[model samples]
Target chain A: MQERVNPDKANLIAGATGDWEVVIGIEIHAQVTSKAKLFSGASTEFGGEPNSHVSLVDAAMPGMLPVINEECVAQAVRTGLGLKAKINLHSVFDRKNYFYPDLPQGYQISQYKHPIVGEGDVILDFKDGSTVTVGIERLHLEQDAGKSLHDQHPEHSFVDLNRSGVALMEIVSKPDLRSSEQAKAFISKLRTILRYLGTCDGNMEQGSMRADINVSVRKPRDDLGTRCEIKNMNSIRFIGQAIDYEARRQIDVIEDGGTIRQETRLFDTRTGETRAMRTKEEAHDYRYFPDPDLLPLEFTQDYVDALDADLPELPDAKKKRFVEDYELSAYDAGVLIASRAASDYFETVATGRDPKLASNWVTGDLFGALNKLGKEIGESPVSAESLGELVDLISDKTISGRIAKDVFDIMLETGEAPAKIVEKRGLKQVTDTGAIEKIVDEIIAANPDQVEQVKTKPKTLGWFVGQVMKATQGKANPQAVNDILREKLEVGEE
Target chain B: MKVDEATVRHIARLARIKVTDEEAKNLETELSAILTWVEQLGEVDTRNVAPLTSVVQMSMKKREDQVSDGDCADDIIANAPEVADHFFVVPKVVE
Candidate 1:
């Protein structure tokens, strides 16, 4: 609704000691969209009955061996491609050793030395129209541990294995992100890319997608300082707040002559402050080794080529095409391509009509309606074709722009076709020159005193034009009424 | 792999297993000997060979993605050592 307060600038924390530059790297865990778990046949549906979606392998029962899920691996590869990252043909899954009841398996099956994805870059678009490319370090596939619930029973805690063994792509980024907005933008753009690929449903509310941010502060032009990790930020707003709070907290610590500890901290959303969850000294040294059960994942270039051929038009591509082909603004194109459904909806309405008008309706009215009704674009009562028809009616001047609005409102409420609404309501523009001229003459004959004043005061023509349009119930073509008023009244001749 | 006295105690705690001091001293000797035997692999000079992670050369076989199993909470709870209300109960895990 409004411009962001601060312009895109260097992420500097001004301190009494010095101006501290904040550096950020994010590790995002995106759950691969699959019907089954990574190594088990269990379902991946969220909010299922506790342990009702689990398989024996997920429980780590005796003599249980894992069979890889094809869909999950394909999803990971698809996600890697979406990020513009290199896909490693042969990557190994290692056992990340740790012990927790939630992690039924004594060690987590993950990738360490050899991840499935190599280095890539994500171009972040700022509100100021400037962009920065953030480097993606690596992306690897891993299994999620179970959920430990502490609230149900006061005396005893419970474990839900429904989430256990669900495949997650752990995407690690280089310390390239500087500002909080840049970080938020990176996640949002990445989420859009993931959703476009149909690989991962980036639903943070359901724990399908989450971020862990590594934040550090150093003087400008200085080497990176000792960093701390803020764990499990689920929302973009919370991620920004956490980075702001943590960066300031670190600057304060250093200025007070205290060394910041290299540790994992938890961001308390309610308190808006971070507290140490675990110190580096207490960190677990995960003795990683390749899993003995699963073999190295390898595929031919032909397989990757097939997936690439099937790749949907990504956000960047769609945005560029919207700007170039549809002649839309970058901001408008960005809004349109934020989701595939919205983009497809926009294209349907923009095909033959004025692209600017279509953009305004899609971004302004349609989105406003959807938001007000708490409905998704796909769930819109009015079809894209209907909206497009309404746009056509307006573009051809069959209906006045004002009349088209009323027609659109009726279409939205009744889910009726726009043309039908205009026809049934008799709302078409009165561009018939005969009918319009008659009204113009009638108005002039009745308002002679106002017409005499109109010659010297040319602005008085608007009053005559308004009267004509009002007499026609706002269905008169405004340009036609202007010409008729000026010609019939002969006000402009003097 | 160095098996120092402190590392011996740390490994036990990392695995969440109880080990007595006397047992750690004895285990350290055995562990050091095993590691020394493993150290002989350092002399191999074949530098171009790929590290073999899996002894088997087959690609991982995948199954059809489905939820053909589960929905048996009673069976799942039956295997747990302590179960309360169809959930595996443990000492409360904070954070």
Candidate 2:
């Protein structure tokens, strides 16, 4: 693989006037995977009966004070550590004052100035063996608003407090991305890290994780342009489409001699366009202040150290180890370590076996079968031991690679061990050179015309080898058959 | 620290409160006086002192992440102005 190159050099959009560079920053709100709400003793289940998971604190009842959930705080710190960020020894929560139907307290409890996480970096890896380090501005802990169902009734919207007060870690990135491809890669790598840390599930479809993208376009080497924020993008595909559209829209506005307005816009997936939201007549003034009810969150360095010590090996490190230890290619290492379960499966299968062979089997054939069956690595029918055993049989010359493939298919269907399948079906390779030589002699005797042609054109010796394998029902040792044919036909003398 | 009529009207709208022009006019004088009174604290020469994080000096209390309280849908909606299917109903907000 080639050395990693700067992503900034590869991602400049050509416009009508000239090449315009898109500047992108993202704020990802990842719901913390905790059993209870952030400040309430309520179940943090995804889909429950309306208001079924709400506590008195979640509903903001009269004189109901919020009590911090320790697990949620630990989760945020773990996420910060997973991002290799600076964990603030002391952080404070503030009330972001706004009026919304989904917000029961008329304000969201968020972090304004002192977030729990400080500056970090996420390394975005591209398929071209190139990399970009996206700087994380900060990560803060916040409370999620509830759901508002407007179409439930004609006159009134129904509010479900089930999601209210749920803990969310807002991971904000600096404006380092220059294109939609970089943005997509940044989000994907961040999501993989969060999932590896077990801090967030990173399920976009479930609204557990979402993105607010800030997009702007400027001439190369020019000052930063005014940016508009796209709110609540849940899909990666739609995020790319929205950024492309929004950047082009901003470029067109500037080309028409109109300045771009900084506002929050929503992406219309159906239309593949972004339109400005019907903002309040006045610009948003969140009027943030420290929450009077909750005190400042403080922890010791030992706490952060303990959490960091317990973190699993993140994706980039694991991929590096795979490349170094297994001698797998960068792309193969990436595919094998995309998920924890798949990586674990590969490690187990490659423990004592040929690592390159195991990597090929796991990433190629096994992954293909899993995709066809709609199964994750955790639900694979073929155990790691069995797959490793199949590789071992190929390595030891107990079965040819072609017969091993058939054996692997049977192992997938029957969940049987590869060795047992080979034994039961008598599919072992004819490694007995005597038997293979006899079959090769018979095939050569019947094909003298093709043998004569092979002396002139040496590549036609494959025909004699193929005929020997066909005569032996593909169980002949292919190398032995080729060796015997070349000796019998004297094709190797030249 | 002057709170004008426009500022009063903006605050009123943000608080989701209805106000008459006369009320806003009165609030402009009252709110400006309150801000002027609160601004007197800025004149103190205690620049080196840290901001008071809490009135009580105790650390923030935390609870374990366990579902110890919930499943009270009926009690949660008992005080709502309108409730249906255990959900609080509000004026249609389409944005």
> Candidate 1 DockQ category?
medium
For each candidate in the order shown, give its overall lDDT on alpha carbons. Answer: 0.88, 0.91
A1-494, model 2: which lDDT tens digit per residue?
11122336558887789888899999999999999999999999999999999999899988999999999999999999988899999999999999788888989999999999999989977778877888888999999999999998899999999999999999999898889988998898898899899999999999999999999888877778999999999999999999999999999999988999989999999999999999877557889999999999999999999998999999999999999998998888988888898999999999988999999999989999999999988899999988999999999999999888899999999999998999999899998989988888777788779878988999988888778878877888888887877888888734
lDDT (10s digit) by residue, model 1, range A1-494:
11122223466678998687788899999999999999988899999888999988888888999988888888888888888999999898999998788998899999999998898878877667888888888999999989998898787779989999999999998888777888899999989999999988999998899999999987776777899999999999999999999999999999999998888999999999889894545356899999988888888878888888889999999999999999999999999999999999999999978899999999998999899999999999888999999999998888988887788789889999988888888888988989999998899889989989988898888898889888999988998888878787676633
Score residue A152 of candidate 2 by CA lDDT: 86
Task: For model 1 chain B, give the 10-residue run with minimal summed lDDT.
Answer: B51-60
Kindly report which residue stretches of model 1 are placed more than 4 angstroms away from their true locations once superposed: A1-13, A278-280, A437-467, A486-494
Model 2: DockQ vs. true structure: 0.86
